[model samples]
Target: MEIQNDSPVNPKQVTSAQERGNPADVAQSGDFNNSNSKKKKAPDTEGGTAKGTILSIKLAPATDLWTTLKNGSVKLRMEETCCGGVSPLTVTQMFQKTVDLCGDHVAIGFKQEKQWKTLTFAQYYAECRKAAKSFLKLGLERFHGVGILGFNSPEWLIANVGAIMAGGLAVGIYATNSPEACKYVALHCEANILVVENANQLKKILEVQNQLPHLKAIIQYKFALEVRQPNIYMWKAFMKIGEKIPESKLDEIIDSQVANQCCTLIYTSGTTGVPKAVMLSQDNLTWTANTAGKMVDIKPAAREKVVSFLPMSHIAAQMMDIWIPMKFGAATYFAEPDALKGSLVNTLREVRPTAFLGVPRVWEKIEEKMKETSAGSSALKRKIAIWAKDIGLKAGYNNMYGNTHVPCGFALANSLVFKKVRVLLGLDHCTKYFTGAAPITKDTLEFFLSLRIPIFELYGMSESTGPHTVSQKDFFRMTSCGKTMDGCKTKIDKPDELGSGEICFWGRNIFMGYLNMGEQTREAIDKAGWLHSGDLGKFDEDDFLYITGRIKELIITAGGENIAPVPIEDSVKSKLPIISNAMLIGDKRKFLSMLLTLKCYMDDETGAPLDALAPTSVVFCHKNECPATFVSEVLRKHDPAFYKAIQDGIDAVNSKATSNAQKIQKWVILEKDFSIIGGELGPTMKLRRGVVLKMYKDIIESFYVD
Candidate 1:
């Protein structure tokens, strides 16, 4: 693969569907030269030789966007014409192929009235078309956004595909986003229609509707509307409104779309600052979905099953739930809205999915639950379980380190404990288990490995269209993200003596620049066309990528030591079983200090952290003979036992530190745990360091007081 700087073809000249011929004919045309730009090597089209044809792409119209981009538009440049084995099909063509191949196969499944209801590929396509027509009838303008604020449901999927089908940008707003955040995204894309999940989401839209001049209508997909107003329609009514729209009109718009034009806008989590809208083109979605699906070995025609419960606003969930399933003809089951609050395991058992991807936090929660359950088991059962886990760990380490020999009693352990544990967790049928979005601690990874479950790690960002590097079963490593998928290239921008540097990506999956943020886009994709990932990583001898730390998260102490906080924080949490979160402080200070939050109970309905201690925390307290049952109780009475136990854990962590600069000199426990509601975590549960610094400014400042 090769990328270079060059002048672009005129957007006005390439806007028409007739001028921009289908990319499928690239092998035949052999027009590899892109206008007057520098000639670069193009990827081989699927089933073709190592040569590709030129694809003229028209940039998206600048509507309600900020940009001083080249030619006053976001740069929709393709460094390579096609990627390895990628067909470069548009979203419409790709979905059409799947429908043609598996028209009668189930594509989506949802629970209704205690029974699983499914939609076939043909039926799903029809629903998307119906929704597209409705969007057209509601006066959706070309390139304008259609914001969908909801959980992962059939309606959400339909609206997502429908907007793109009708030549509009599909913008997903995080379900947990505040009304103000929602307004920022909706207005940024100049949304013409907002499809919300229920009355609660509708109320939020309604609260800000008066301020949105571009919003023409709002559709509520679930529950009865408590307030009625003009231009507000229910799901069934919204579907009917587009009946008068001609099918030909929608078809014309769909046909006009090219693989390089923007179709979706994924907003960042704003952990650093204001969220940037990531412009993903048709090629980005289709190529990434197909390539990544194959990397994980997704079976076709409903052979593969997945539970969709993660936030769709994030690229990971959207790609896994909607895009990948569509590409491979896999069946997707929508988990309930409260799936994360302890109901996901029940759904997993019923569906018996073949593939599952959970963030680090979700996996941690499951690990905690399993440990709590094990602690409550009968003495004999606990003993047997421990024995099995010991055998499991030995076998797991052997396999991970490339030893073919299975440990003694492995078969017996699997049957007696591992199999039962998998069945109880509804992961018995799961062959591919994945964890991503945030760095998972080695402790959590090893715990799952002890159960004969190896959770692979995937590494990528929204700009890379997800799954830049994926750890497959055969290409597994303990803490490293596996090598890049076929056709993608990875590079360490500038290496230190230890070979750590910014991880850069080059592939068809690279997005079409950040929407309306040309300066930021230029910063992200350098002159060489490599998309610079701000993450710090280094490749091992076998080329596996190990994420060391994030460039922005590195803390430079006053003593001139550059310390990575994640590893140290993970170490602290591993030593202290009761600690929920540990943040390393002392950037530009004498030594490190820590702010911690204890494991506490949370309100399942609202996802609010409660004052009471969680079951796992209580178990820790019982084992240590500390009688506190609530976080407030510990704070109200600084019990020496609890403090001593925490101090011992910190001391253990510090003893393992490389130097004095890295050791935690002082520490304080926060009143509450970090959470999305508390403005400390992102939608995907990634820690918002910027938000945390501001929210606890006084506490952090006091740590530096001499």
Candidate 2:
């Protein structure tokens, strides 16, 4: 895949060696050049020993070298057995073991047709076993792929787990995927069975089924569906056939599973080109859970509640909702896919969850809502809020990193201001919140931190199992992604004056390799064992990792200056409550420009009364107001502390940018937010850059015309 440069830098133009820093001189020099070519001695066999060679700084981007090292370790790690030297088991085995141990616990909760339903651990296990038995009964061979097409439902999880249990690799088809996209993955993986939730999902599969020669059967989880094809079977009827087998036989099949076995085939949501199917082994996932558990030191009994809403198909959600909770024996409350607005508030109130995970967009929305409420309060109430916020910020910062003991005057602020704010946001029951999957604005992070809500920023990708780094409650840098997780090695590939480069990871959690795409897999995981995370990042003096942006996403201006769009977009979006998505435009242009999409909170008719509810007489425009005005109002209400910061950002871009690249010199506000259903976002809620560019081609073109 070609890395598109929207900024100033021409990707084809490589940086000269003389401009780069020597790795030998840095304090983390050993970590930078830990390639196998140097023949360095392995570290002690003890768990904490740093056996791998330290990285050596190099001038060129170290993508190829890192991939080699990571591939080697992926093989080695999979070969190593866990659970006291029994035959090595894969991630699927670990999941099955947990279900076996806790069959009666609540495993999944969801709303089916507007009624809440739940699956006990035993029921969940039984369903998976049944599905697996059905697959095996249908003669599905080991390593064959099965595609699952559905929304968030218990059946989706059951089919996913069943695919692995049956010794077939499971591939997920995003519920929101187009028929063509689904066809691409099914054909690419050469899937044998397609498991779908309902007739609607089945239809999409049918559209592309003719193109897939390997497809042997289609299974529908829902009953009473009209399917004329002889190859299609109802989920209930298929399970009945599996039920004929003795229970002990199913248990035996599960026990015989091994760690190196292929389990999941996840496709990367790359911004450009066809997605690559990532092949992950059971060992890869289990090791990831183990390493992540050690890093966070999660207590099963203490912090048990998690509000799960992110798509399970995404690796981050799987880690947070499935693996982490399973390992910790924690309870997770699933939210309805359509009820995110009300379900979020209701779930928190009902479950009083202690931990939750969200993408930056979710938190940004929360911040916007809070500001909207605060916009028209009385003068006296505003004064009280400001005072309370100050006290809360001080105490919150201290409490976050373990400095909960409030000083004399600070105690007054918490009682008067901060405490109320927490109650207002319905976050009074939360201990901490994890934000990841995309870059979060510093202002948004600080605002929650100030409100005494512990927002711990984390970073990772599908290829890495899940999160590789998370900020410790008390020890966090505003600019950093957090320290590397335990059992993982991290370093920069090439250094500029800022000591930043492509972030490389060598750890037990890396995936086995991409599925079926040997050349691509080899390219991603080189001969060594280090995974080349394409993210550009830098380390501070304290070793905290700060992600700048995707190396491929960096924009080079016509002035020869490279600008990372992530930070800039994050900064702009954080301050603009009405804006949900913002893409930086103009590479090789004099300056940066942007295309901003407004987040639709409520319909104009539904929200117009809110403006009347406000004490101020500011007129409500018909969703056609200047984007800048809407953004300014949002910043003024939500983040009063960052007024100067927001102004500075706008001024900097305006002054340095050429007419084309200048600070969105002319822009339009999108009437709706980007969403998966809207075809503007991917399943993980990541903006589809190409889709957005195409959809808004006219608006973008208008900026340069006359």
Candidate 3:
């Protein structure tokens, strides 16, 4: 695969080191090209290819790539396209091929009231074909968009597949999103039909039905609820109408799909305002699944049992729940959206899944629960736990992506200490555990590793479909997300002293562009074809990508220091139990401070009351005392390592910030957690910075006063 840099720019017009007044003359200083002149040949290993250890990989300075354009603009080659030998497959064809190859295999499983309902690969394909016929009957063929608004269920996947099968684009709206937000996505995507889960979702659609002029029909999955509207259609009735359609017609519809055709419109959970509809084509999804699979070592039979609980609307869930399993012919178990915790545990035990995907929040909950149960244990047990954790970390690092070379003492520790921890969490059978969506704390990651669960961290955006980089077992780095996946190039543009810069990527896996917003799309993807990820990241000498934060999310203090709040917040949250979400305020202010919301678990009868839980204040807390006190004491007794990490992070944040933006001078932890339903968080659980600032304007103002 080759990156085509065909942008018209004269070489003579390009800036030189002398013109920039740089004395180093870095690019022409030495015989850098001769560094790899003596390439040694190696004997072929498995699959007729040389297998050897990767010594090192590093990023050259930006000064090396920067050039002045004819238009007086500075241009640099951010990333080279890394396309592998895989061809793009349409969403419809992907499912059809899977069904053809594994007809009797279970394709999807979900709860329907009491018993779990399942669909075989062939049955799933047949239903999708019939649903496609129904969509065609509704005049939704060719370039049309279909919206799916519901929680995780068989119908949601059916609607998604059906839309694509009919040569239309699938657009997913978060079930928790407000009516206005839903309307925004529907209108933005120009969706003509919407498949809703039940009456509640239908009501949200109805509330803004008039606002969406293009929405012609609303199909509800459940038949029990009554929706007295001209546009409403029951899912069963809709499918029954297309039952008479011949299978040949479905084949024709499937064949009509092109590789570059739009498959889905995934709207990102924008932290600033309304979300943008990212236009992901068949090529994008196919390449993403293929590349991401290689990075995480997603093998065919090895990755069979996968327990999926994240929202299907999001890219992370979409990759694991829909794409990856289908590509590898793996069986996936869907967890009930309402009872995620119950379903997760039950599914883990019942399926004994080999692979699982989780966000940082879910893993943190598991860590918290584990520590809670083991707190104040015997000294022998404590020592055993420590010994087990050390061993597990070694094993975790070695076997992260696929490498497995456990140390002798660590192997013994794993058998003695970590084995029970894995059993307790139902992770004894899990071969691969992945964490994404948000930055995970190293301490939190290490805690899971100690439990014998290899938690591999990954990084990506909605535009990339799923994780672009994932930590390998042998080459794992807690601080970095991982190396770039096979067939994808990643680089930081205009890096600072810490090597942090706007992360840019180039590959077939990148989305086509934002739907309908041509101007914004052009701005996001430059003339050189690289996608500006808008995230600030850096690559280490080992090629691991360390994500700092969103470039737009940087907090520039009055002292002129630019702070990336994501890393700081992640460090703090990993240490503090009561805190759930935090937003670092004080941009252009004297000192840095934070507005935090308490974890919802603290309010439950099972856990002790939080000290900051004030029910009435603008910045409410559950109680009046410091919520960190109990958490600190608990950690001090059970895990001194974790306790010190938290203390160190707090001290660092205080010392690093200017006087005005220093460690939250007057902090108030909210009683309630920020959520999409509450208008505090986006659908993807990202804090809405503007909304938060407005909500706590007075409290923020108090910091400025005496």
Candidate 4:
């Protein structure tokens, strides 16, 4: 796909936020000359190819992230991109320009000590530079991985920029990973100098430091109770040492940076087993940042505002929170990590950001809250909501002449109903809201559409630099991952009779491949240059790609019919308001079954997390016990009303399935929810199927009578 340098940000008014929500607002400017590129066909419209888009890329450098080759090749060789016109500066140099333009502007905000705290762009830049100087003083080498372990924070941002600015690699570790998992990353990545948040992280690192052969110094951020150690240094003291470094040294490091070098290592969410560090180059990052902004019609220099609530350890968040802002001058606000469940909505309301990104879960929680709220409200409020929602659903599919646009009555509907909902949900200013990192149910997407809030679904993994495909702004297909992103070409390798195949991706967007694991890297990306994403997908006649399921995850039943579990599982979750996770379990079995976990059921009147889930909704027994016995014993203990509700939810899901092989035949509710700390979920909240299956092996086996 191709996009032109059509809508450049007005240099005269650099302060203006690109508030236009529609892509059509930015007219096509530069010529689309690439013969391979497809042209604009509506997202849902069949049989037409979108005219191919040709985008001019720029080279930016912020070298070496995590995981090193440590091989004979001192500098890794990779294919380059067609970067047109101006040669972009290193990431730090471009950031310096951004700092100059967005100086004194409120760049970041977060809650601290029960009050809101703010940081200006100028101040943020200064902190990053100071932190860089301190890293230099500590004798950090260029391209050395400076491991960072923390949630999203002002200090984390500063340290990341600072490390890269000082010509060192910035490596982020998931704050939720186990001590063993943490040790694996630190050692494999070859990090010596590490920065961590608070005492809990420090405690974890200290426990593993003896095992970490390369680790030497540790820098600690905020702590209510300080821990003293020989290698530990307070953040304030670290910055003070920066004053001793020569100012010219910092500038010299920036000048030496090159675009083709590695920038960061974004580890894949290893659902099957151990994660591999995917090494992304500076050009890979810069290209993604530049194209992402263009895809959503966000101006490169415009001061767009966005929420940074997702983990910085994840690639999507890295693009949105770090790279997007640095490339586009977008103001990013950090929501208190602990309070994101309760406080993010309020923060978003206050920020009223133009750009919003969320996983399906985040959107579902908010959507569920609205449903519960509407149920308890007065008659008139309920009627108005029902009426407004009808309008919204229509507006979502409303075609304005040739262009697909929101129904003309949406403004009226919004003023009457959706306006209040948007205000309450804190999305009044959200123009481009994206959902990815996981598949969203059709019901959840429809829920947002029924609310007249455009929540577009995109598809990508850390291997593909976050977004490989994105739904067009106004015209989008809820069931699809949308059109291919600019600079990306997709191929469905050996499709089945049903047209589903393993999604293979090519172009400049693919990563430089896995670090150290040569065999794995070669397996993932062919010498021909196509990165085989294990996802089973298909392109519509209109070229909109639809992700079906993962190739390895397809369940072949006893009847020999293959089934996709995600859709069935997603269906169950959407049908059941309280269910947080639903894993289908019928591999080599008679029929499909599921293991269920609720998201702490809500109180009917108060809309709060219910303390008791009708007392018997959960099955309780020994870990080794059979599921049938567990459920029987649990049922003997209390009223069956709760079980009936769960059964009804299961039935609802089964009704949506097209075939008997696809429908869930039986299920069991687990006593606990799948959690990251529990080793059932990755840091990105993706289910670790192997871990979950092993942990509940007994529960799964009991589904069949033996």
Please tell me which predicted candidate would have the highest TM-score against the true structure. Answer: 1
Which model, 1 or 2, shows the larger lDDT? 1
Residue 227 in candidate 3, Cα distance off native in Å? 2.7
Residue 491, model 3: lDDT of: 58
The local lDDT score (0 to 100) that residue 631 gets in candidate 2 is 33
Better of 1 and 4 by lDDT: 1
lDDT (Cα, tens digit) per residue for candidate 3, span 1-706:
1112233321111012233332222223332212222223222211212354221211112232211111111112222223332433467656665666677887787666757777888888778778888887777857667999887777787888888888778888887777888888888777889999888888999999988888788899865657677668888888876776777887887765555546787887755555877777675676677567756777755537677777788998889888888766777777756434334666666666778888876787677656656655788888888777777777777675566688668767867777766676677788778888877788888887766776788888887777777775655777678777665666577777877788876555676666656677777876555578888888776677888788677888788877777767775675465467777787888776777655543433212334333222111112332223343333234344443443554676666545544465445444455655567755555577878888888888887776
The per-residue C-alpha lDDT of model 2 at residue 402 equals 66
Worst 10 residues of 2 by lDDT: 1-10
Q: Write the per-residue lDDT of candidate 4 for residues 1-706, one digit (tens) a residue.
A: 1222332331110101232221111111122212222234222211122444332333232122212362211111221222221232356755766676677677777778868788888888888989999988887776667788888988888888888888767788888866777888888777767899888888888889999877767898777537778778878888887798888988888766655456677766666667788777665677677766667677655578888988898889988888878766788888866533466787888888888998877787677667667666899988878778888888776631134576666788889888887888788888788898888888888778888787788788888878877775744687788877654567777777778888876544577667788788778876445578999988776677889998788889999988888988887876665577899898899988899875554443323344344222333222213133323344455336556667777888777777888888788867766665567866666777888889999988888875
Worst 10 residues of 1 by lDDT: 8-17
Error of 3 at 331 (Å): 1.4
Show how many residue pairs clash in every candidate, following the order shown: 0, 40, 20, 13
What do the candidate models score in CA lDDT, each in turn?
Answer: 0.82, 0.63, 0.66, 0.70
RMSD (Å) of each candidate, 1 decimal: 6.9, 9.8, 10.2, 9.6
- What TM-score does candidate 3 get on C-alpha atoms? 0.80
Error of 1 at 683 (Å): 1.1
Model 1: per-residue Cα lDDT over 226-259, one tens digit each? 8888999999999998988889988899877766
**Could you give the candidate ranking by TM-score, starting with the highest?**
1, 4, 3, 2
TM-score of each: 0.90, 0.79, 0.80, 0.83
Best by lDDT: 1
